[model samples]
Target chain A: MQYSNTIAILGANSEIGELIANKIAGNYPLLLVDQSEEKLYQLKQLVTEHHPKAQIELAVCSKDASWEADTIIIAANEAAEQASIASKIVEVTTCKTVIQIKKAHLDSATLHPMLPYSKFIAVDWANTTAIVEGKDENSLSITGEIVHMCGLKPLFKKSLI
Target chain B: MFEVFFSQVKDKVLLSEAEQKLVKTFFSPKKIRKRQYLLQEGNICRHLAFVEKGLLRSYNVDDKGIEHMIHFAWEGWWMADMLSFLSIEPSTYHIDAIEDSELLLISRPDFEEMLLKVPVMERYFRILFQNNIISKERRLISSISNSAEEKFIHLSATNPELIKRIPQQLVASYLGITPETLSRIKNKLNKNVPNT
Candidate 1:
């Protein structure tokens, strides 16, 4: 399941972003943003058909993450754009959790609650989706769920974040 | 050619001479000139390069054509676009030599072959990835939560070698701050905090 409030997915036109939206659109009220309005509408239609319960909205992409969202996913392939979007989100959002969905070095959630964004780079995208679906509070347990979801052994992997 | 890598592998798991030789056979050595690119944006990253000596930096250009530094790999470090390396897609990042460097390059096929040939290498890479993950997590925490001055101070305390080796501009870029901001932060640190 997704977060309680609105979850905005930036770069909805991109392939990876579209894939992530497909995985996550079922559970959350999604605000899909992309460069093309037509593409966003198509995605919204597809997602709504697949997930009738999902509340979805479409908007054209902008550099700023100005909308109110509890969680934000910058799934764009461009690393520079991701940083810019993330920083913009951090600047505008009030105590929101921002998750970067591209391949990055880190898995981060900023510590301060008062400060704007608590960011997490969910680099392991498939496992991240699996873990989120389980909604198991424990991270370790989520890793186990992810391993089970992938149908693979843990193979001595440690300390999933 | 393989001495530095063999030493690293030895630290994690023991490798016999034959195993070491097999591993070495998979990696080819290359010398990169300063400012010469090893990988470019829009091109598939063919090899994961390990720095036997000198420095390499991975970066990207933004919409306004502004360059942002993503990572730096000095001696004993690895530099590659993991997404591109694993998926064989066009890299969003470019890697270039900061200094005239010696590197050991392992192509995708050769890397897979090496893993099969030397089963113990799995442990070596796992440990390396683990270390990378830990540092990245720590870095992300600091970079996100802390102020520029605080970030600079923490970086100086922990990885002084990085600040010493890399230029202030690149350091500022890596920290997601402007050079002027970094300079101001350092100035403030020098004034308020002793031994900065």
Candidate 2:
């Protein structure tokens, strides 16, 4: 399958996710999938506030199925527990990395800062290690490549099984 | 064994046939005697050593002269001082053969040269680094958040073979638990199991 540099932020309305989206949105297509229309509107405004040239679009889950991006990135903490979101993205888009910044399990190893691009944001993303539990090596590699492209580090280990 | 390692790698990173051959060329066979140091502290780690046989460990010595076990490289595992390897700085950790070992060593310059020769290798190494980063992040999170008992259970469930093979002290260090605590936990587990 042909995959583009386009990255979809599953929870784009998120404060940090928006910042992340804004950074990559300039170069590639940025699709924001969120639950709230108001938040989506606010995110669009936020993107325009800093990046007026950014090609940002808002898609609500409440609406019909319209997410058509090559890569899907789940960026919100709330979506971490959403099995539906995970399963849906797994079915459609090719997710490179699922950045779950939940309070319970924070991964800070592969962190990338927004704006001024050089300043390293103190995030758990880069510091947290990934324990990949997958059946095949191709699956792990695909996921690993996505994280690397996002400028995050990842490590591979076999599953308990 | 090399085939097995390559099989594991081929699954994650996509490399062309020619690119794969170039990588296979870097696999220089070397045997390390038990207790021998492949790379020492204060020396730049010039090579990324992949295990072909036997066991090895990478460890850091603290100010108190206590060695903190970073990781163990069993058969078919990769071990290196990543901070030192990537930065080309003097390594603080020492990689030693825990058991008489065999490895395929590739120097940093050769590895980078190989990557340049084959750009797909850059993608492979990038993914490799990411995978390592992910595992480290997960281990740190689990160690900090989970209780000692919980960590033991997790380790036992995940790497029972490692628990059996590695020394208790190293396992304790990996789990971020005291040796005494690990002993106690093991005893508790032993007592809980039926006397068969």
Q: Rate residue B100 of model 1 by lDDT.
A: 86
The CAPRI classification for model 1 reads as incorrect
Show the lowest summed lDDT stretch of 10 residues, model 1 chain A: A130-139
**DockQ, Cα level, model 2:** 0.01
Error of 2 at B98 (Å): 0.7
Model 2 interface root-mean-square deviation: 19.2
Candidate DockQ values, in order, are 0.01, 0.01
lDDT of 2 by residue, A1-161 (tens): 11133456766766556766655656665678888889888877877777778777677761122224434455665533333465554322211223333223543233221111111112234444444433335445654654455466766654422
- How far is B145's C-alpha from truth in model 1 (Å)? 1.3
The residue-level lDDT of candidate 2 at A92 comes to: 28
lDDT by residue for model 1 (A41-89), tens: 8888887887888877776644233343545666666766666566655
Off by over 4 Å in 2: A1-161, B14-17, B194-196
Q: lDDT of candidate 2 vs native?
A: 0.63
lDDT for model 1, please: 0.68
